[model samples]
Target: MQLRLPTSIPEVQECLADGAVPIGGATLVWAAWQRDGFPELAVSLRELPEANTIGAEELGAAVVLHQIDDRVPEVLHRAAAGVGTGAVRRAATVGGNLVGSTLRCLLPAAVVLDARAVVLEPEGHFETDLSDVLAKHHLLVGLRWSAPIISGYRKLDAEAGGPPPFVVASALHADDGGNRLRVAVRDGYEVLSGTVACAEDSADVLDTLHRTDLGTLDPTAWETVRRHVTELLTRSVGG
Candidate 1:
């Protein structure tokens, strides 16, 4: 009902403490509203500060997607743009993407990137790994991640006229950094999360993707879909 925009971390924290939901462009919030309903008191980061800008401070501040977009048009920026359309990007904030847990595609990327987040609790201000923060906190101020060594993102959507990626695999060449593998179901629903130097080969990755968390799919049908996606990813890597 009311929108409060705060320009500083302290101001943002104060508002959060007062129970106002921090808003960053409000894309996910609005989308959910179309599917769900209003949440509670809200705050917009649009005019609050340069939440979109990234740089030394961002690396220091635990740069979020918007912040990365603000500074550079890197891999994450490309992935963020793929989210919906221009209209959505104009309003969406990186922080919102993480806070909205049901959707975990980008968050996993952040995790694989080793991004961290700075939180302002009533007790004190401290930093936590992005994944841990997402699991623990209902409210988040912003996030930060180490710059990727070698990173790429691919999505399969019906609109693309291709089979949805049973697993949207993101690989980061973080050997000197932190080798990580992130695989998630497209459309932000099914998510398989882990950090490993390598998976059980591409076939197993596809198989795991098709199985779903509860093992709900018929094995035959799962194998079909799994094979299709594996071929696709194989072509991708080959190319």
Candidate 2:
């Protein structure tokens, strides 16, 4: 119905407060929203400079996958590179990947990276743990994460061949005590995460996966999910 393209965060917030739905690249829209019909009032984040942050530690919501660089993390780069065709990569935004009804592989990488989200809420803008922003359904503006000592990613393609793949990403970040292991798994439904103090805490990140949350997974889906997670764990510890 109606579309508002705001160039500033305040303007974007205003549009949102006025009941406008936030839109990024709209690539995910065709897959998840087309059948339901589009929202009546929508605001585009594309024109805002803040939504274009592609630096090493920060990634704006509207940042396209093509703009991602090696500086962010190898896991992120590999996941972004495997998402879709070159044209899709050129148009898909990180926000779209994370906020869509499901997800594009990138969400798992963001989770493992322990990324924090910068968001615009009704009260004002604020930064919080990425999981909090996601759980509360806030409008994400950008993401920030530190470089990890080691990072890795793996994806299991959809057999039907069109849907986004199941992905698992891992990162080992240094802490005062030691390097901590962060692992995330993304099925077709959502992204999930877990961690261990170090590689010795557990041989695998299998505990991170909550199968019951997946509802009904046929043997095929479960195996693929398990397979990727195992692959990431293997790579993470050099097994």
Candidate 3:
């Protein structure tokens, strides 16, 4: 019912301490409010400059989805490209996408990239894994991660441009003599993740992926998806 616009991170934190729900773009918040009732105190982070900026180390939470598609890593860009329509993408914030939704395209991509979220708590700001932050109801301020050597994302959808029932993202990083391949799958409410060493056998990587316990998908269907994802990763790694 009540709205407060904060211009700085400290002000945003103070508002949060006062029990205000942080809002960015308000696409998700407005939808929830329309379905249910509005919260007692709502804080708008739009006025904060840092919340809207994208930098080398961190991406501001309030940065719009389209900007992320343009400026972030290729995996995140691919994920953002699959989000909503152009209008919705223009209005949706990165933080909102990360925090408001459960089966989102970006979360799995972020997971494969080993992204970390910088959150604002009542105590102070702290950096934590993106998966951990998603598990808890934390106030996310920014996201941080180092770019990988190669990354790819694919979503298997029933309809064109619609949200897919299953989404997969893979990232490869040079580790000693071999490469470390990380794959993550987002299937409805369940997230399945696995890592394997891509040294001599690529089939071994696929086998490790099949071994992941994706609770939402059946074994047969998961095998099919795993094959497709392995092909995608192989092409991305140019191997």
Candidate 4:
């Protein structure tokens, strides 16, 4: 296995063009390392061009999940801090999370925030809404998230040992004008994606997403959970 570190977008572009896989913290890749065999070339972005520019405001506030120790205190950040345990969250990155599709909870948040993904493909760079990225299995280079006046994320877990989210939901109301909502269902490898309930459209955007399912929950129990979350988000967002 070979490793290279580049410090500019052009260098990254060249690396990707050479078929090297970009590596952030290597958590996700290492998790499946033996399964797919070690990467022929692992390009570390730690000192290279930073992709966490995707922010909470102007999509420039994105900090790698590990970089959230004391900078941001939002509940979402806290939740991200605890995802997959202390060590993993500290080493796993938001970019890796998306690229590997390891955590479903993050997807709903990206969807609700109307997050956009900037993929440094071998041919050229392209951007796609995070919602669309989550719907497919792709090699994600980085992500961009526009700011939100009000944003929140929610997830439910099973007996507490489930590896991934069962149902996840996120909502964001941007002062820019339009509001956003998203809900996603995950079961092992099968994922279900959907929009919010229409009746709650005008309500606080938060309420719209609360109707979604986020967590490692069983589908049989998703309906009841979904209803409760809907009512709760509705009351909070004044829907």
Candidate 5:
């Protein structure tokens, strides 16, 4: 196998043009390789500065999970902190987490944050919504978004230290007369999102959430999750 380390965007693009598979952190990629055999040529993005830095409004795809947990918004930090363990966080990159799997915590948070992804296409770099980027295969370069007024993330696992069965993220923004609430839920397979005017009471907010489709959740646990999400939103908005 040939390993190419590209320190610049142009160099990385050249490598991609040569049919080299891109790797960031390689946590998931290396595991996949071990199970399904390694690729002939792989491009390592660790050397690219833009792929590892945290900008004012953007996070490089290669930024480590722990860095995000430590530096980014609390919503993103909560998502990052649930990624696995301390060692896993050290080796997992935000880009890898997003593009590697649809079942990750960060994607839901990104959706609620109205994050856009910078994708490197054959023509040139362009911006797309995180949801759209996830739907289609794209070379993700980084993520960008304006900070919201307040945000929160919650993950529910079947058991302690196990993969989360459900993950939810909520963000609130002050509007003309009231507040706007945005919520995104990832229930194992797909992500569902909805937005509504923030309600004054937690019960009213919970009712609105129930009316807003949150994808397929177990009926037995739906109420439980709804209450949890309502509490999270309430605490975040100080309501």
Candidate 6:
């Protein structure tokens, strides 16, 4: 496999045009290496300074999970805090977490925040809704969001020392004395978003999920999800 260490965004783009897979943090990359060997052409985004920026409303692609801080939104900070242990968090990245795996705690949180991702695609670059971060043949440049969002997130794991099976996140935006809400669920494969107001909406979401991709999820998991969503909504909306 050929390795590329580009120092600037343009150089990174050029390397990518040559078909190099963007690699950040190498936390997930190393894991993939264990499972399927190195990709034929890999480009390291580490040396590109643009990929490491972090702020209240933006986080560059190469920003490590440990770099997220008090300046970021509360829901996102909470999810980042729960991603992995200290050592693992030190090596995991925001972009890699999005592009490499849905199980990463950041997905549902970012979903609820109305996160916008700036991606470097083979044709060019574009920014779009965070839910579509999985666009094929794209490398995430950063994530951005509107300011002053009220949100909440939860990761549900039934067993101690086990991976969380479900993650719930909500964002509430106030405009003209009313609230616009978005609730997101991160399961094993993809994140689901909805505007959940009552028990019926929750029931529909569960039933739909049951009949769809996550058909094998135990009934208890959906029950727990319902309770968890209620708690999140009650707390966020009431406040």
TM-scores, in order shown?
0.63, 0.77, 0.85, 0.70, 0.86, 0.77
| Runs in model 5 lying further than 4 Å from the true structure | 160-163, 236-239
- How many pairs collide in each candidate, listed in order? 7, 0, 0, 19, 0, 0
* Best TM-score among the predictions, by candidate number: 5
lDDT of 1 by residue, 1-239 (tens): 67877777677677777887656556556777668866567766554444544552253222344335534314455566566556655555666666663554465455445566766654556777765776776345555555554455555544454443333434444465434444333433545444444353776665554444424544643454455445544644675
lDDT at 66, model 3? 81
Which pairs clash in model 6? none
The worst-scoring run of ten residues by lDDT in candidate 6 lies at: 196-205
Worst 10 residues of 5 by lDDT: 215-224
Error of 5 at 89 (Å): 1.2
Per-residue accuracy of model 3 over 163-225 as CA lDDT, tens digit each: 456777888767788678777888766778877777556676776666665434677657756
For model 5 the local lDDT of residue 76 reads 81
**lDDT (10s digit) by residue, model 4, range 93-190:** 66666656455445545555555676555567678766566566444656555554444445555676655545444444434344444444445545
Of 1 and 5, the candidate ahead on lDDT is 5
- For 1-239, candidate 6 gives per-residue lDDT tens digits of 88898887678879978989778778767866878887889997777776777777787888888888878877788888888679978988888888886466787777767788888765777888765667563688888887545777777755665655677776766555555566667765566666532333445544553454334445765565566656655666467
Cα RMSDs, all models? 6.0, 4.4, 2.9, 5.0, 2.6, 4.5
| Model 2 lDDT per residue over 112-217, tens place | 8888888887668888887676677788899889988778887775766575566767787888877676767676666666666654534334443432343245
Pull out the clashing pairs in model 1.
Answer: 52-67, 62-143, 62-144, 63-144, 115-144, 115-145, 116-144
lDDT of candidate 2 vs native? 0.75
